[model samples]
Target: MNEQQFSKSMTYAPGLPEGATFYSAHKKRVTSHAVANAVEAALKERGVTIEDIAEIVLDLQKPFMSGLTIETCAENVRGVLAKRELQHAILVGIELDRLAEKKMLSEPLQSLVDQDEGLFGVDETIALGAVSSFGSIAATTFGYLDKVKPKIIGRLDLEKEGKVNTFLDDLIASIAADASSRLAHRVRDEEEKRLSQNNGK
Candidate 1:
């Protein structure tokens, strides 16, 4: 049925509250899978892929992890992407960038975002807030990438025309940093498990 028909068909549960109504079609239950898909789609629209972030994670983690595979790095990146906190940050930051690209923002804000001015630190702030959940390692790694602008981050930062990636570049860095931190902790856990098994023997 059409949306209006569907909305009309919905009935409120037994309740005494006056003017209370059932959820509408626009308020349909959102699934975790749908949110995850949107986050992935947002990244893809901005020319980023899981592998792109995974490569940075591998660069950050491989030195300390023997025989580390790109597949493992990609897996950890996916794991980080699944967090609601990170997903929220990705959506918000990308939306801002998109708005800026369309010059929808006002005055100094629009100019700052479009130019990605040196004084414009809000982008990094949002990215850092999201990565902070992963602890100090992730936070510091984000700072490094923000400064160095390695690989995809560098490319995004350098794009001047027809795009505004002020927030996206830092968001990508944060994602990679957080994933690397997660992989590090996972490796440490596995090592400890092995050591504990050896001690038990």
Candidate 2:
């Protein structure tokens, strides 16, 4: 088919559910802000601020993509926080952790989730899926985060004060990985654009 015809065919019909849309502004704003707030609060509790996350992002990105400043890394993290898919993943993963903590699951499942069995692997799976959008860099970054367990992630790994963060530790790592990947891509795009302009000149 022609490009115009293909484009026309891809448009959604009216009256579709808000969830069916690629980007529901209201849902995106609310969920993204909530998830961002939760992340900030968790980090604050562990004595890690946004500046720390920015520095971590800079560390994660500089080796992969050159000329990336700390300010750009911090802005990219905010960009990741604004993404609808990231928000959804954060909300869902945290909800699952909360459910497990409450022992809401049935029978053997409850015990398995509560104990965070190695064989289960569901928590990592969810986190991996969240980072998949950013490609292979995300996978490596996630491994780095998992290994280092910086700040909030390390805190979340420990069960303290009757709070369980079984899924959250992995989820937070994925978030950082994804944010780093986002920054890398943005930097790459800008570099490409500059190179193209120079070539044209």
Candidate 3:
């Protein structure tokens, strides 16, 4: 139930079209699974079980955005990650964008920019995983997490191309916090479903 397996060939593509179930479901599965694993691992580290951490993470990681979208989720994910890691993600995304803008681009990373290739979004997925992991924490600094949780797809920076480190971090912190909170909801949902089945049996 916690694991998400998808087609290996579907990580990256040109763009996320408006109505694409595979893309949407795949991204959501990847995101939820990452958050779930993070909660489980964090609780384990603290000598607890998945059920114990569920409520905490859910209270922590609710999405800030009213309606969650990939772009918005990505923004919150980036900020919610952490200081050093957010910086890294911003830098990586910036560099990728910059590389795409360059006069002469290399073949290896070109697909990453052109969006013509399918594997370009791998880095984004990884960065989201990191944020989900740390966002599972329920520290007080989570105010920042609360503040930025609602704008999952909003702009991180006003006029800059890639200065999203500080900007996006704020938003992502909220997303992470909200996502953490959602963990409790998800776990509870799973438990209810299981109990209902057992009762039927």
Model 2, residue pairs in steric clash: none
Question: Model 3, 24-143: lDDT tens per residue?
Answer: 555422233343344334324323332322333333344432333444333433333334444444444444544554524587756444442444545435345445544344233345
Writing each residue's lDDT as its tens digit, candidate 2 over 1-201 gives: 444344323444344444434433222222334556765665455444556667778777678776778788778777776666766676776777677778787878777777877787888888888888888998998988977888767867876665667677887788778888887777679889999999999
TM, every model: 0.86, 0.69, 0.30
Q: Number of the top candidate by TM-score?
A: 1
CA lDDT, candidate 3, residue 5: 64
Ranked by lDDT from best down, the candidates are 1, 2, 3
Cα-based lDDT for every prediction: 0.87, 0.71, 0.41
Consecutive 10-residue window with the lowest summed lDDT within model 1: 13-22
Instruction: Show model 3 residue runs off by greater than 4 Å.
Output: 1-82, 135-201
Candidate 3 weakest lDDT stretch, 10 residues: 162-171
Model 1 error, position 188 (Å): 0.1
